[model samples]
Target: MARVRANPQFCSSKNEWKMKNNNERTAAVLGLGMMGATLAKLLLAAGYEVTVWNRNKDKSALLAEAGATVADSPGAAVNAGQVIVMCVHDYAAATSILSQTEQSGWKGKVLVQLTSGSPAEAEQQEQWAEALGARYLDGAIQAAPQQMGREDTPLFLSGKNAAWDQALPVLKVFAGSPEWLGIPAGLASSVDLATLSGIYGTMMGFFHGARIMEHAGFPVDKYAALLSGILGTFGEFIQLEGQLVHQNRFEKSESPMSISVDATARILRQAQESGIHDKFPRYVAGAFREAADKGLANEELAAMIKVLRG
Candidate 1:
């Protein structure tokens, strides 16, 4: 069974003895890109003995100045710390870096991958780490570099339960309360892709809306403000729609398919009349048109999922 641990109200415990030993205070950060650099800085700020390394030696300068030990190689960095955090470009880059480290260096080390990749890649890395006798945890950071270490930062993680327990202290330094999705090793990546899909879809609509404001001689900033103001309410609506889809309840609801059909068609017509780009509106309108044709016009808006499922 998959073990899921998620508590919205959960906060990182401040009990220092949880990581009492000097070894627990030590950490290694590989890859000094924007996000990786931020992670190393956060560890240093939290009184951790941070050892950092990067392909470009120049990237380690700032960290070295901030009291971080700059390792000459990945293996040296891994050997210097009990917990190893890697946040490189991709799985390929990560693998290339790890290849330089000897298997003996990885043995019994807690390796945390904050690199973003597909679920398959995550599973592959986990297998490789386990073969080297390392405890591996795959994580996906949902926020930008500037947003790291905040109480609300959402970091999705998945791995063995033992690894989760061992790395909890180190993980808490990066995220106030990192969410442990399960032990599949790919749950973090899967959730990351799912959330990104929703985010990008919303961004498309926002971009199209911005065009509408520009064409109508209204300030785009005002439209952006409108979006920001309604995020909470809109999120709630999205949650309800998600529930409807999950339950397969397509009966008449607060928002029916007929309403979306009319709204989308009107938006598309307005875009055409204004001589603006109608691609986004046209696509959405087409989907609703198909749903209507399929006799789901009176069903809930989430019934549109059926159209997609086909």
Candidate 2:
């Protein structure tokens, strides 16, 4: 359940409608980029009155056709709703429009910024919003725009209690899992970027490995069988990984058999001799050689994980 929040703008009987009206729930999304437009479509679909603002006049037209109200300017978009969602490309674009409201007051609105950026950027944007009197929340979109509105895609969130309290009810309208880290704005952003970095790093390693295998005459399509077989044992690998990592022991649990090294080194040396594969073996073998030279030769190839940690 979303925690009830008292918006600073809420006054006495004159502001009673802001507190009690169901139809009063509305959202404003600035920026009509892929992610921004996607989020606007989602809010509209979820039955919230949605308003949108985009610098490019034509950008908001599609959302407008999808039952969103397009505003001429950023301030107009924010004025149309109590909850404003900013999904610009980054901090600069979001701040460019939002900075327009600095001289004016923005006391009552809830601002949920979905711009993807560094932790420092999230923290800076939080302070920028506070200067305008708006409650700010930092949020991360863990999936592509096409995945928006899907259940459990993963969103990272953090900010003041008031901002989170007001936004949690709308999580059903966004993508996959929604994780609230803490009150500090950038905590979630840091996790999001770090997670993506790991994803890309693994992808590069997979691509490089697959390419090298193919260059050595092992076509990837044929190799996928072995790859699939290996992947099926991922849980076991992870278990062993945990044991190795925690115990600080990367010993001969899974020996690099002579057959395995002979086969791999045949490819490694062959690729190096042919100038087809570059220094991959340097990094791979360098760690193993370090272990092998250290008289840990009896330890399994998995022990290289320990050497690399060094």
Candidate 3:
């Protein structure tokens, strides 16, 4: 077992102590998939007595070899540890596993849910945990499994203030910075979804641009290099857009709505002529044109927020 290194207190507001004992530092990890297994290993390496449970018993074999106790069932795992970390496939799978465990086993245990889910689903799970007398915290791991245990790995967390304070020390063991978003049960999930939206939107733009380059017979490597240069300025543009949106001031901009609408129209035409799927370009063009039609042609491209908000 690894030695437990003491660290400075991260939470200022202390909650009622809920560990099994003052010195007991046992953690139960349910669902030994890539993320779950990584977490279990990190906990063990952090000197926690780790108990891991997986639907497929074989999945816990490696962790068992690493000195982790493999539990026969979710209930057994929950009973064995003061803290429970669940990283199942989704909200449904998490609920299914929880249903199998005896509700009485949940009382006094801290349940840290890292399962991917919507805000509504997260809220529902929080209510369920509360009804069962478990302290609940909804979390979203912002990094990949390989990035686990790194100091810069982000874990967005939201729950009752007391529950967060109780789990902060353990959470800090795996995540370099565990950000407390709010006391709302679903706030973490909401932030996770919003971040993913930006990622997907950027990916879609890259795909569309790559397709255009391919149609023009441009070398993909060269196109990718050019794309990287453009993307380097994206952070600045994003910051400006955010400021404009927050201040509700989108006029006198570098790129006006009329220019953006024209550029989008050209991209749509190029996509159509190249026999490429023009849906993406057309969608952008439609949005820009809609903003223009609303007399936002003189405003900055960020003025489209008005159309989107409507």
Candidate 4:
């Protein structure tokens, strides 16, 4: 079994660590899924010596054609790189791959896990990595596979400060802006999940809106075009809402809870009348009404945070 005998040490200071040459910085990508393949390609484009390994040998062939060294096994891949990135399906799959690899090869390696998982799972993975004397960084990729090498690709990362510093150079190659959340291994996952929650909520609203418009004999494409205009202003609204929630001052209102509740009630009625599924509208109306019932009727729409907290 291959084992990493020495940890890749870097200065604790924030100053950038210089490599003897770009080729000296090696990275190994464990999975060759869409996102993982894109990442490996980005590293290769950045001139890093990249080693790739996938469960299916055929998957690594494409990367090899692009100048990546294909490893025969996970242990060989781990041994070939200083920075090891895993983009497997989930925390379980990631651990399973690692378990099969020579355990000793983990020492002194920096393991960047971009697997989708809960915060608790990230923490567990961090502990497991630490036990093996490996530095672990939990990360979440905020962009799609096609956006991997773009300058705007955002990667949320959390881990020990020293380890983060050590891994920054290789990480910067893939992410245009790699945000360091904190030392807690689970922070990146938590933030990622929170961000996803808001995105999914907005998507559900759009889906419901589209369904309602279709039921009303309206052009769905036209509705989508009109919605795009309104969606552009959501960023400003979100900023204001965040400020209000942070300050615990939801009194001043652009749109009060009562008004939103009433508006949502109308939406529920429309869905019901059109014989369309009202589940999404009903769920939203319930939250708005709950806020109003809590005596926050005059408060801004941001006051719904109270109901959410409960």
| Candidate of highest lDDT | 1
| Candidate numbers, best TM-score first, in rank order | 4, 1, 3, 2
Query: TM-score: which is higher, 1 or 4?
Result: 4
> How big is the positional error of residue 121 in model 1, measured in Å on the Cα after superposition?
0.8
Candidate 1 at residue 92, lDDT?
96
Best by TM-score: 4
lDDT by residue (tens digit), candidate 4, 1-310: 2221221231211012225553247889999999999989888767676788888877877677666778878989998888999998998889889997887988888899999998899989899888998999999998999877666888999989877987898788877778899878999999999999999999899999899888878999999999998887988889889999999988866777888889999999898888899999999888887887899889888888888799
All-Cα superposition RMSD per candidate: 7.6, 7.4, 5.9, 6.0
- Candidate 3 per-residue C-alpha lDDT over 25-135 given as tens digits, one digit per residue, 9 for 90 to 100: 778999999999999988877767778899898787778766677888889999888889999999989989999899899888789999999989988998998899989
Model 4 TM-score relative to the real fold: 0.91
Local accuracy of candidate 2 as per-residue lDDT tens digits, 7-95: 23322331354356643567788888888888887876666767788888688766665667777778777777778888877778777
Quote each prediction's TM-score.
0.91, 0.74, 0.90, 0.91
Any runs in candidate 2 off by more than 4 Å, and if so which?
Answer: 1-24, 102-105, 222-271, 277-310
lDDT for predicted candidate 1 compared with the true structure: 0.88
Clashes of each: 0, 7, 0, 2
Looking at candidate 1, the ten consecutive residues that score lowest on lDDT are 1-10
The TM-score of predicted model 2 comes to 0.74
Per-residue lDDT of candidate 1, residues 123-217 (tens digit): 99999999999999999999999999999999999999988988888888888999998879998999999999999989999999999999888
Model 4, CA-based lDDT: 0.84
For candidate 3, the clash count comes to 0
